[model samples]
Target: MFRLGWFVNYGFGAYGWNQQWSGNVAQDVARPQLFEQGAQILENAGFDYLMLEDASVLYDIYQGSFAYAARRGLIRQDPMPLVPLMARATKHVGIIATMSTSFYPPFIAARLANTLDHLTEGRFGLNLVTSSPHAAAQNFGHEKHFEHDLRYEMADEWIRAVKALWNTWEPDAVVYDEANGVFADPDKIHYANFQGRFFSTRGPLNSVPSPQYHPVLCQAGGSGVGRAFAAAHADTIIAADPGIDGMRGYRDDITRLAEENGRSGKDVKLLHLISPVLGDTDEEAWARKRAMNAAADADQTNQLAALSYISGIDMSTFDLDEPLPELSDRVNGHQSSFSVFAKLARSGKTLREILKSRRGQETVELVGSPQTVADRMEEVMEQVGGDGFLVVMPFTRRNLTDVGDGLAPVLRRRGLIRDGYPYRTFRENLTSF
Candidate 1:
């Protein structure tokens, strides 16, 4: 059996990228303290990890940067820094940060992850994203984003190189031979001379080996290139889809991919993004969702955010009250956009209908009481053969406390959720497949 995890879907730019493309939820709706509070809430509730996505460039779902400042700012914090802050607040849950193999060098990536692993006491995970969109590459001084297939090809080698650097310092490399005044055993240190199509890295990283060895590798790509990268290196795969059959297909596809690459079903864990609308009863849950929907100015903000992040479509071009225009395949490479738009067209949804699909991306939304929520979760797990789920809340900690405080108990009652974290490290928890 696999464990369940939650995605921290709150905080700075929680709804969308850039200031102009907000969910219209006050700019300062959540602060650092609140983020810290959320970390505590999820950690205490037995969440496996919190993901912090990284992007070098900020654009609307349409991929435009013109309205970035008008929106607010591209993003607030450098995502890498958030890992340590979150790690300090939680004892057992993992800290996963997104780092692009396209921009950062292998040595730097390895050292940063290793440092976080040490700081987090071995509760670190790596969400390996191959940066897409030309703007993202331009920010990093590249002329253009590498083609999709090529990016994954580079990522494959990048993973091996980073792992080699990480393995440079052996488990017993640090030796406090006080009598001899030797702090490290020279024999335990090795050099990683890695040369690949995209990079040539030479290293013995500044940090020593962490308990997790290679921090739990996570992949958030859903494309062919993305799937290939995940199969090769990912320990956990993040996916967003609406139906149980789709989740199962994705799970099985990745499992087969892993096996073809010489790994097993247990080697990689599959997580579905779950945005839950929870209440005491089914009717109450539906009412709460309606209230949240009513409170949110979904039309302008949601579509704008979607256009900016998913496709390069300009939200301002479309009328807020009007039905969504039949959009062309304008996606720059992100698969999530296509999925969202497809849902809109397939369901014969209007612009508002699509915008109101789910506040937090197009992940399958479960609306019901705690028992209903847990039952749906079990169905997704047992019937779909899913490893776990990434619980995405509709609003802040105030609006949605039921996932942990309410639904988790129901899961526990059915022997689905663990009573307490049974492992010390992130890998140990995830690898118990």
Candidate 2:
């Protein structure tokens, strides 16, 4: 049995305006109702949380122009206000908001998360990140993004400072003792004077710690520094290591790091990414899966453009059949993602082949009838010593309906998904393992 979560590519959805069904939901991106509808669907499914993935920079790296991104609308509005909108729509489902340490100040991040914690009634999570886009730096007034290790160094201090501010007011500090005329205990409220390499905060956070202390910290760490950063600070780590062997190795390494860092390995959850194509029968499911993979042209093109944008090379100009040259120094951002792409390139995969592979890269495909999918999920969890999975499927009402009305029912019958949330707070439910 394992917990499940949904990852939203909020920014990328803006680009989905070109889809066939885009006309029907033209305002979904701009409107709160659409997001609320999706949140409600997940809650009905007994999903743990909806993690909103965000990126601030308008990506234009594909061909030294923003044409692909803008034309496709691969941009996003601010995600801050939408947090409460989603919160108001659901009671149990946690709301995970992505915020960047590299871009935002420590105190702002702390205050925002604490406020969201109160707003969501302890059902909020922070997907803390060290941003790695070229335009992100420029947008934030920086000449260039920090190096990979340096970014994590800033993030380490950023989190430490934020947590210090969050811990400024003890839980017992709030006392509505009107009879005695005492509002709160001053002794329990202390000032946070934290000074780190990247940040220094002085505060008793106006918003007291929410039910979960600080919202659950969800991190996606892929590189060596990124992994150590997650092991040191994250409560749940989102990973993309492919295959049973890769997953087992990742789990072992992170769990070991957690223990060596003075925490129980069980305290930290590891969730790998999965994209499943579900249907009623094995034949239909397999057929659907093949169609989806064959429909990989969009991902292949969009991702190649993305690869070019991130790796600082116009892959659009490269020979689709030529073996990719060594890119030891070309990448100036997201070394981890570029490294994965680079490996595919170095493996003699053509540009076309690489993009197609990217669509299914780092995936644990769970395609079959609900029962069959659940069986495969069980096998994967057992073999890899699992925490759980984060699923990313094509966005459609049917996609969610199938998972919620179809797959979840099957999982519940098998005693895999939870019958109900046992605890109130997101952290409590998330760490219930």
Candidate 3:
């Protein structure tokens, strides 16, 4: 059996606000009940983790206006506060929150991660990201975002520093010896004293070492530098490449990079991002997929706006009826995402055609009955020499039930996925398979 995770945006985004299945999520967006319930459902389904994707800025790069994004509810709430709430609601399912290395100081990030790990009993994972949007940089008081490779370079140092801080309190550093009037062993604790090109931290962390010592590191880096950073530091890597071949290639590349970095390839789990459209029957599933595609085609402008926000390019400036011109290599936003968009453009298809073809940007879609989808997932895992799949979709009650209640049971019965978590910590459970 392989691992399973859920990828979701923790925001009042307009994603499924109009859908009946969404229930009162839109009305109760600010409340934690909905998310807590969702986390419980996933935990009961035996999912390895739930990953929350975040952004710190209101995007305005689409048509040089924030109106489209704002209307679509692109503005996001901070994800950090939601971590403990969801963690309290679920026992086994890991909660991974996206945090920006570009903005968070090493000491603060380490402390927060350590605290979350303790609160979650080691079910917490941190998805380290180098914030890409120039608007995000501006919000953090930077006029410009760092260059693609440079951001990764800074992140590499940031991870090193954070890890060093996490290590300050050794595993055996804490000892409650009231008989000796000693709370902790001072000899076991050491200063981090980390000084790197981009970050510097002095002294050890204040807290005792939590379970797992260092919480699980999660990352999604599609570019070369990003992949290298992930390979060296991440425990689980998220892959968003499309197609079976692309997925296999990405896995292979990460495996190679891991080995090159003096770590065993098997030590890191790679979860490919997928959006499965499941129905009672195969035909029904295909119909749902078609409807999804139609909705996307009708909302092409919003689609472009989202792409513009991520790529930091004014996609509205491009001619929809004509093929896109070669995009510059100097994107200050997500370079890998921009590269994927550029590749689609170079396919000689018109901009509108490209948008229409991509129903769920870069995420592979599995459309079929529950059993059929489970079969396809197994086949893909085998072909990709797998770790697992991360289900990327809008959060709705119906959507969650479709996968957690419908699809997961099929996978479990077939022994293609775990029926229950057997390990104590998330890292152990995730790596068990």
Question: Across residues 228-335, which tens digit of lDDT does each residue of candidate 2 receive?
Answer: 888999888888878898888889989888988898788888888887778889889999878777776645666677677556677777877777767673366666
Poorly placed runs, candidate 2 (over 4 Å): 11-16, 20-23, 309-312
Highest lDDT model number: 3
User: Which number leads on TM-score?
Assistant: 3
Q: Candidate 1 — number of clashing residue pairs? A: 15
lDDT of each residue in 171-269, candidate 1, tens digit only: 889988999999999899988888787788788887778878788898887877678789888888888866777788888888889999999977988
Candidate 2, TM-score vs. the true structure?
0.95
Candidate 3, 1-433: lDDT as tens digits: 7889988854433347666465864565766777888899898887999898888888888889888776666657777788889988888899999999999999999999999999999999999899877888888899888888899999999999999999898899889999999999999999999999989999699988989888999998788898999999899998888888988998899889999999988889999888899999999999998888887787788778778877888889988899988876557776776677778778899999988877564456699999999988998888888889998888887888999999999999999888888889999998886
How would the candidate models be sorted by lDDT, starting from the highest? 3, 2, 1
- Candidate 3 lands at a TM-score of 0.97
Displacement of residue 430 (Cα, Å) in model 1 is 1.8
Q: Model 3 misses residue 287 by how many Å?
A: 1.4
Candidate 2, position 215, lDDT: 84
Candidate 1 vs candidate 3: the lDDT winner is 3
Q: How high is the CA lDDT of each candidate model?
A: 0.72, 0.80, 0.85
TM-score of each: 0.87, 0.95, 0.97
Higher-scoring candidate on TM-score, 2 or 3: 3
lDDT score for residue 17 of model 1 = 32
